[model samples]
Each structure stands twice: as C-alpha cells, then as structure tokens.
Target: MNIIQKTDDELLEIAIPMWDDLIKYSNKGQYGKFIRNFSYNLLLGLNEVEVGKQFAKSELTRSLSPDYDVLGFIRRGEHVSCLFRVRSTKKEGEWLGRMVLGYEKGEVKIFAASVF
Candidate 1:
C-alpha cells in the first residue's frame, strides 16, 4: 500500500493495480470512489477532472491495458510523484490517461487522475 521502499519495477506494479481499480469501480457506477482518489487541494462539485475520470472509466472496456506506460517518478519538494501514461481505444478516438500518485502520510495514494 506504500511506495517508499518500492523500486522502479515495484512502482510500476502499483500503477497497474491503481489503473485496474479505477476502471473496475467506474464501470460499476461508482463515480464517488473515482472522485475520492484525488488529493485534498483539488475539489469541486463538477469540473474537468471528475468528468475526465468518469469518461475514461466509462470508455474503458478492459480492466487493464498493455498501453499503459510508467512516465517515471521524481521528488517534488516534500512529495515523491509518479506518473503513468495510458492509451485506450475503446471509444471513437484515442484516449490518454495521465494517472499520478504522490507519497504522503506514509502511503502512496492516487493524488490525481486525468484523461483526455
């Protein structure tokens, strides 16, 4: 559940589960779970982020895809961040998911998820 001790390969493993869970929850009509993945700073009733997650969730027919690529990890001040680049074509056009994770409170959690 944490990435502090995780190597690059371990971090990549974490991202896959995150991606699978998001798609699973979204497909089950659990948008609330999707919204809860965000960090504290990003909040709103309806906005770009929420819509994008839901849209991606809705469009994803498979739980996980081979199109996902880990964009690597970097330290940003007090936080360590990881990015995963994802591509899916279950819809009319190509979709990209830039999923992000930030290590905080002794655990790595989904801090941001955006798809376009």
Candidate 2:
C-alpha cells in the first residue's frame, strides 16, 4: 500500500465534501454530527487505524443498538479507502462495507463514516 501522509488542513479539505454528502442524505441529524466528529478525529490521527482494527475484531462480542463505531481508512495517492463493519447485537446479521473516494490531483475530498 502506498501510504500517503497528509497535513491536518489537507485532510480537512479532503473530508468536507464527503461530510456534506452525509449531511444531505443521513436522517440522523445531530447523530450525524457524531459521525462527522469521528471522521475528523480519524483523519487527524487522534484515532489510530490499529484501534479501528481492534473494534472491527471485537464488534461481534459487543452490543450495537445504533451506536457509532470507529472506522478505518488508508490514503493512497489521490484516493481514500474506508472500511466499515456493522454489528447488531439484537440480531445475527452483520455486514461490512468498504468505500473508495477519489479526487482530482489538487482537489480535496471529505467524508463521514461509522464502523465496528
């Protein structure tokens, strides 16, 4: 993997568009804010990828109940790849989703995501 290191400003620039999209489509309202904050925290490296991985692994043993979870992403070149694993304690159904975002060479992209 070609790991791309980004400054905080650069990460924000990349994240805003995605955040806007989530706001427009998400029905959670203020709960969506939590997702946005989580995304920013991840991009700022306040939440490490390792922690995300751990959450992914331990999700099966925990309860979900519409709560937020840490998501993980890797920046490669001009694209960002995200991993989201959804776990529901109330049921046996679990799902994992992955998304990729690409931007123009000099442009920025933003996103909000939740995972377990």
Candidate 3:
C-alpha cells in the first residue's frame, strides 16, 4: 500500500479529498476532524490540547480557503508528499501546504501535514 507507487491521477484521487477535509476542518478549528486521516504514529505524536490552542491562536490555520491547486507530488520511501498552493479566505496571501501520505496497517494515511 505504498502511496509512492500510485500514479498521479490515482494519488490525486486519494489525496485531494483528504486535503479538502484538512482545510475545511482546520478553518473550523475542529481538531478531531482535522486529524481524521492521520496515521497512528502521527496521532500519537500530537498533543490535542496544544493543537487546540494553536488552532485558536494561529490566524493562518483558521482562515484557509476551500480552494487550492495541487502543485505536485514527491516520493520518499513508502510515502508520497503532496504539495498545494493554498490561499486564505480572510487574508491576501497564499501558503505552501504539504501532506505526506503512506501506508499504515495496509491503509493509506497521513504521516504528516502542515502549512508553511
């Protein structure tokens, strides 16, 4: 279930919807929904309270738009990193978004995700 082996279209099929959910949940400050697709290890590494605080304070995370453009994908080991050009609904700038996908328990899951 290595996502790196998936074709661009196949990868987009899986990644885009997840990315959409990420942006949607982040904007709403819904920590649980934001991490719904995260891998077990990623979930374990996150501090829910810290994330909630950040969500409440970070202007960027709370203002993401539903629209985005897929920049491309990068492969590393069993993981595939998807890049997006994301714009803020409440601000006048764009940001680079990254979502790393890989297999966990034979299912595709997010290993890491961030807006930088």
Candidate 4:
C-alpha cells in the first residue's frame, strides 16, 4: 500500500469526515450529495431508497444509533482502502466496515463497502 503522507489529525479531521458526510447525507435521504461520494459501480446498481435500506443508514440519525469511526486507510497507487468501526449499544454492538476508495477522474470515490 502506498500510504498517503498525512497526519492522523488530518485524516481524522479532513479525509474521514468526507466519508462521514457521505453517510450523513445517505441517512438523510439526500441522493445527490450522497451519491457523489461513491464510485461508479456502487452507485450503478442502487438507488437512494435501496442505498438507505441496504446499508441500514436511514436510522443513523437517531440518538441511539450506531457510531461510525474511520480507523484509517492504506493507499496503493490510486486506490485507498479504509477501515471503519461501527459501535452501537444494541446486540450488534460493534462491527467493522471496509471501504475501498479509488481516484477516478481526479476524485476519490468509494468503490465498495462491506460490513464485517
């Protein structure tokens, strides 16, 4: 992985927040802003409602909803692999999600994501 020479503070304060914003917009059902952060394929087979339902992101705005933390990312050429920790008080209290990001047309977009 070709790591980006950035401070944790920068990743936390800048890069990570960008991904967080994607989820925030997703949870709010704002397809325009939400879809902009994703890569082509991830956005291709899904619509706004499906994206919300599939990710269970619609409930993310609730006070008792799970918290998402961007652990970090490893960059390889134009690809960036991100790790996130999802914490909740429910039965599935803690879990991990992996996001594969890549630079396409000069934009860093999430190409894939999966719960682990």
Candidate 5:
C-alpha cells in the first residue's frame, strides 16, 4: 500500500506504534531497535557509536516521554511527514518531533526522524 495515500487514521495507526517503539528503544539506548524502521539512507547517516554518543550526551533524548500528541500530518510526493508534540520525562516543556515515512524496498520505513 502507498502510505502517502492512506487516510489520516490509517496513517496514525501505523505511525504511532513506530513512534512509540522509537521512544522506547531510545530511552534504553538500544540503537538497533531505535533505527530498525529507518530507511536505508537514514541508517547510512547513523552508526552504533554515534547513536551511543547521542544517548550518552543528550539528556532529553534519553529521557523522552513515551506519550506524545500527534500535531499533524503532511503528505508530499511519495512521503508522509508526521509531526508530534514530544515531551521529555526529565524536562519541563515539549519539543517538536518529525517523522517522515516512505516506502523502502516495498516496505514502510522512516525516511527521517528528528526532534527540535
């Protein structure tokens, strides 16, 4: 199925769990699980050592709250960008998290994921 063509509810059904897993794995510093759904290019830009460094240095990343609000969704070309209101378990406020989804090898995958 083309993820970009999916309904908002359908897309959320797929994305939310992946987002949850990303948070879960990140909190545990599990690089492999955190990036398991990432696309090939996305994974190419990251490595275990670099991710470990991030897990060690970024308190916010390490303390991400699993519960997040879906801010919105944007569809462009073959991708769907999921915006989220993310919070840190140890911090006071929220951050914007973006997870861009697209097809890779005929399977759904995260093209990019970031928080700011």
Candidate 6:
C-alpha cells in the first residue's frame, strides 16, 4: 500500500490486516520472514511518527529519534530505501513526512517521500 499521503488512521486500517495475513503465513521462510519483518517495522515506524508528532505539539524540543519498530530497508531501483517516519514541529507540530533513505551511486541519499 502507498502510505505516504494517507493519514495515520487510514494507514493503520490497511496495515493491520496486512500484518495479520503475514503472521498467518509465517511458517514459510524467506518470503514469510520478509513480510513479517516489513509489516512489523512499518507499524512501529508509524507509531513513532505519531508519538513524535504529539511531543512536537506539546512543544517538546528534545531530539526525536525515528521509530525503529516500523523502520525498515527495501531495495529501490539501484539503492536501498530506508523507510521511516519524520517529525518537524516548525511546520505544524507532530509528524511531518515520510523519510526515505536511498543510495546515490555509492553514497547515501535521502529523499523526502510522500504517499499518494
């Protein structure tokens, strides 16, 4: 599912079912492991983003770490995309965007991602 533009509620609805399905078929290796890991990590990242947004709204200025629970790596084109949630209080408080980390040639890269 494309989660970039969807609200948290929408994402949760889609994600939970996918996660459950992954768990149901987890006995298979490789593919099963990948699905489970991806679903788990994605959920964790979403939660972190939500919490971070709340903290930002409360005007908490502490450095917020990306939620690792839902954070994960995926191969995209020639690079690996590190998918995670990002928060910026200055814009509007709470979570701001989806962070994507990719490799450019041989160097690390970051692409501000949006789901549509």
lDDT of 6 by residue, 1-116 (tens): 23344455544454444433332332222232323334333444555555345434533223332221344445445433333444432333344323343333433333333311
- Model 1 Cα lDDT, one tens digit per residue, 1-116: 34445677876777777776775655555667755656665444358665656556555644334456666776554444665565554544445566667665665667666555
What C-alpha lDDT, on a 0 to 100 scale, does residue 1 get in candidate 1?
Answer: 35
TM-score per candidate, chains pooled:
0.57, 0.34, 0.96, 0.61, 0.94, 0.26
Ordered by TM-score, highest first, the candidates read 3, 5, 4, 1, 2, 6
The TM-score measured for candidate 5 stands at: 0.94
At residue 44, candidate 6 shows an lDDT of 45
Query: Which residue pairs collide in model 3, if any?
Result: none
Pitting candidate 1 against candidate 2, the one with the higher TM-score is 1
Per-model tally of clashing residue pairs? 0, 6, 0, 0, 0, 6
The candidate that achieves the highest lDDT relative to the unseen native structure: 3
* Residue-level lDDT tens digits of model 3 in 1-116: 56788999999999999999999999999888899899999999999999999999998899998888999999989899999999998888889999999999888999999998
lDDT of 4 at 12: 56
Candidate topping TM-score: 3
RMSD of each: 4.8, 12.6, 0.8, 4.1, 1.1, 14.3
| CA lDDT, candidate 5, residue 109 | 97
lDDT of 2 by residue, 44-93 (tens): 75454554454446534234433423256667765676555555655576
Local accuracy of candidate 5 as per-residue lDDT tens digits, 1-116: 67878999989998999899989988998887889999999888877687799988999889999889999899999999999999999999989999999888898999999989
Q: What Cα-based lDDT does every candidate model obtain?
A: 0.60, 0.46, 0.93, 0.60, 0.91, 0.37
Q: Candidate 1 or 5, higher lDDT?
A: 5
Residue 15 of model 6, lDDT score: 44
For model 1, the local distance difference test gives 0.60
Tens-digit per-residue lDDT, 48-104, candidate 4? 666656546424332223367767777666566778876544445656766676666
Per-residue lDDT of 76 in model 2: 71
Give the range of the ten consecutive residues with the poorest summed lDDT in model 2: 23-32
